[model samples]
Target: MSTVQRALAVGLGAALLQVLMVIAFAWPAADIAPRDLPLAVAGPQAGAVAGTLAAADPNAFEIITVTDAAAARTAITNREVYGAIVTGDGPPRMLVASGASPAVAQQLTRIGQQLSGVPVARAEDVVPADTDDPRGIAFGVMVLPLVMAGIAAGVLLTVVIPTVGGAVLGLVTFGVVGGLLSMTIVQGWLSVLPGPYPVLAAVAGLVSFAVAGSVAGLAAVFGRVGLGVAALTMLLIGNPLSAATSAPELLPQPWGAIGQLLPPGAAASLLRSVAFFDGAAAAAPLTVLAGWAVAALALFGIAALRGARTEVAAPAEDPLPVG
Candidate 1:
């Protein structure tokens, strides 16, 4: 085969792979419907309501029977459930947390309205998205640029610095800059994410660190290919799997579980916890980020040590002869 033909084949193959990945990550989400989506039910008629909803569409909701409307409301605010149905003598009331996932909230509301054998009185948003970005798209999508910046920083720092200390310095510097910049755009300028500014900035910083560390570690081990791998893992798989546009349970099967385990997914979940749930569910995701950062740091050390040993073993070039 000619060199030119081989190159063309490789390029086309790469392009096709990218296209397929995009379709795999995005196309299915276009016409999203509930799939074991968490929902709470309250009052005496809760069992009947759950039974009716289940009978209609068995896969639509994962119902949790709560004692009362107060408990149901608590579940929504804590982000324990996406929405709730409250059954009483009068019309049934639907409560939801739009802040957790606006799409899920809307879906639950629709389901509540269409529920058979009982009239749905009203659908209320217990927790809504920030005023500036009511739809919450910005909150989810903005993480893309932040992750990209982290990846770039990781690769560049590893290439230029080479030493573990220098790499640490680079990571810290980039993380602070990225975090502050992100906080400014989301909170200061747009007011899409509400203060406390310091808390938001800290969350951003952690995300930056986790992403940067992972990329740098990969690059240290695999060179250029590492960067591409990191990009694919974080952006292509992590972003859509994170369920930023919806809830994790709404995602298809194991992809949802896998997404939550990745850095991008963990970061997104942590931010949501801080922003809407008052940091109630922050512990688990925070631990996930910390674990990634620590593991990457270890990788960085190994690479640095290996490079140093190679330098020590290599024969020195003969000094130029002086006249």
Candidate 2:
């Protein structure tokens, strides 16, 4: 192809990709809806309250009836439920764990107001976000940089050390350094991660490893095209679909469901569980991240072996005898 034609093609492709990203991300925010969101209802009238909520939105909530407000609070803190409605003789009370997701908390409070026969009063946040980050969105912000770092680490590693073993070493070092540094910034300085330091660091390391290893594997398999694909997948598709600023349930339809299974969403879920839920609901997300890491590593290994074999089969380059 001519240079001008090639440039035009590249430009058009980049423009199209950007447009797609915009649509993919904005579509969810345009029409937010709840889907199988966990919730607790307390008191003797809990069953009735749950029924009413069900009638309003049959598929919205997975309601669990608790004995009292205390139990409801416990459930929220443990991440067993996102929010709870505590019914009693006076006005109803709603308990929200803002640390998990401020957007979800706000939405649940609104739901409580609409559902309650009397006025609804919200209790103090069971697990509030960091004081500096009242909206709890800093967590989402932190994720972007870490992901970018992972991408950079993976790409640079391939450029600097093309061997699979070298790339693996680079990924390990990147994971450890990036994880600790990020944890120090978000947890130590910002007080965003209130969980145990060891747990937070461990999860961070896993997230880093998953992202880097996946990118490295893609590059190993498809060369430069693989790098572009990996970038698009992580930045355009994975991150936006993650719904890190809110609960996955608060996002639109299948996208929300799809996001939770990806690395970004899983990492966010795991972090929330660790920080606000005492690591109570972390197992599923942890498994998801582990799967990503293992799969990526396997792909990288296979590609490396194939590359080595190809090199062995190829004829050696002829050398000039004189200068």
Candidate 3:
């Protein structure tokens, strides 16, 4: 291609990349709404509340009926649902877990007001967020740094280390140290995350390892091209689809579910679970992170074997002539 054409092509590519990044980050926020969002209706009026919610927005919530308000609280604590409505002899009460998802809680609070025909309805936050970061802003802000750390670790290891084993060791060490450092800042200093220090640190470390390992493994197998691919995927797709700023159910359908499968999304969910819900509903995210880490290790193994074979097949050079 001519010089001018190449320049134009590069400019166009950059523009396209910017456009895609915008869409990935903004689309979910623009399209935020409940789709099959889990909710509970407890007490004798459970059926009536469910019917009313169905009439309002048939697809808004996946209703789970329970015997009483206590059961509803249990469900919320267990991360089975975002919120609940309880009805008895008196006025209805709304139960929310703002720590689990402040966005969901706000929406449910609105719904509760509408249901009671009052400007402010009776609402209780079963699992309130920490006082230091009531809006969950700190938690949301944590995702990007973790991702960047992973990308940096991966890129540096691939460029600096000559062997895959060395890269793996370095990545592991980074994960552990990074986790401790991150927890110290976010939990100890800022007091954002309220989970047990040990567990939170462990989850953070695993998240770091998952991202860094994947990137390094990809680079090991496919060289620089693989590094680019991993970085872009984690930054553009994984970060946005992570729904760290909001609940997954609040985002567009399927994409929200799809996000949970990626490292960023899984890490966000896992962190939230451990921090607020006492590790409730943490199995899926844990599994996803583990799967990525395992797959990355497998990739590293494959690259090592390939490198070994290449070395074995290489022809030996002739000995230098003696004087």
Ranking by TM-score: 3, 2, 1
TM-score of each: 0.90, 0.91, 0.97
lDDT tens digits, residue span 197-306, model 3? 98999999999999999999999999999999999999998999998888999999899999999999999999989999999999999999999999989999999999
Off by over 4 Å in 1: 1-3, 116-121, 311-323
Ranking by lDDT: 3, 2, 1
What does each candidate score in C-alpha RMSD? 3.0, 3.1, 1.5
**Candidate 2 ranges with C-alpha deviation above 4 Å:** 116-120, 311-323
Candidate 1 lDDT, tens digit per residue, 1-323?
99999999999999998897877677648647778888999999999989988999899888999999999988877777888989897767888887888888777777777763355445788988888877888987877777777777887887788677888888988778878888988888888886478888888988899898898888887888986788678877877787777777777877777888888788888888888778867888899888988988888888888888999999999999998
Q: Write the per-residue lDDT of candidate 2 for residues 156-246, one digit (tens) a residue.
A: 9778986888888888888888888889989888886688888898889999999888888888888999888887788777788888888
**How high is the CA lDDT of each candidate model?**
0.82, 0.84, 0.92
Candidate 3: misplaced stretches above 4 Å?
319-323
Predicted structure 2: lDDT = 0.84
Candidate 2 vs 3: which has more TM-score: 3
Highest-TM-score candidate: 3
Model 1, position 135, has a per-residue lDDT of: 83
